[model samples]
Target: MRIVEAIGIGVLILLAALALLFLRRMVITRRGGTIELGVRLSTMVPGRGWSAGLARFAGDDLRWYRIFSFWPGPRRVLSRRGLAVDRRRAPDAAERLVLPPDWVIVRCVTRRSPVEIAMAERALTGFLSWVEAAPPGESTPDTRPYRYRAG
Candidate 1:
């Protein structure tokens, strides 16, 4: 009877944790425009270490939140300043296994570090436009004019 009680308690705790995660995601999506994006901290390996997450654009900054995380805040906040696009490409054979077939891989270099973001072609187009867009009297020196058309 004691063992049964402990198992029941554990199940309840797990259910509550899942509910918390669901609520957190709802709040994040409601806060701003969210897009499905996968981020890799280091781009050293072409097809590894990618974490699936949702990203929100907030005042020239992109905030990333992991899909199944407990943290209420963004795990990474990538600012537009000092951001440069290294290159973009289609997923390799190995990457195809992990990433969606329609997604494009964009490698970017920020002031702090390098990151790889995998997203759909249309989404990438929008993201690039956001990066290239500049405010009045403000120029993006590190960022050069680059275009990616969905094909």
Candidate 2:
């Protein structure tokens, strides 16, 4: 009986935590048109696949939070400066499972390292605009326009 009761309590706690996380994400999204778009991220490892997450534009940086994590803070932050968009393409067969439906993957190089992210076409446009929106008098990292490739 005690074991069963403990299990029930643990389940309840887990549910409560999940609810809190959902509420937090909702609040953040509701504030100031915070676009909570789905994205898939990839590192520099060869054959390393993509991981799903939610991305939002926060100030001059793009903040990424894992889809399954309960943490309130972003897992990765990509700065605007030193950001260069290399290319974009339609996701392949295996990538379809990890990326959002009808989204394209963008390859980019940041100050720290090279990273790839997938998002909807509209969101990708917005991201490019954000990167190029640096105010006058500030030095832009890569002047080349973002180019999309046929896949």
Best by TM-score: 1
Residue 23 in candidate 1, Cα distance off native in Å: 0.7
TM per prediction: 0.88, 0.80
List candidate 2 segments past 4 Å from native.
Answer: 36-48, 141-151
- Residue range 20-127, candidate 2, lDDT tens digits: 878877765665535445444444544355666667787777888776777888888887766778787777776676666778877777768777777788777788
lDDT of each: 0.82, 0.71
- Candidate 1's error at 136, in angstroms? 2.0
Off by over 4 Å in 1: 43-46, 144-151
Q: Which residue pairs overlap in candidate 2's backbone?
A: none
| Tens-digit lDDT string for candidate 1 (39-108) | 9865577578888999999978899999989999999998876577778888888788989989998888
Give the lDDT of residue 19 in candidate 1.
99
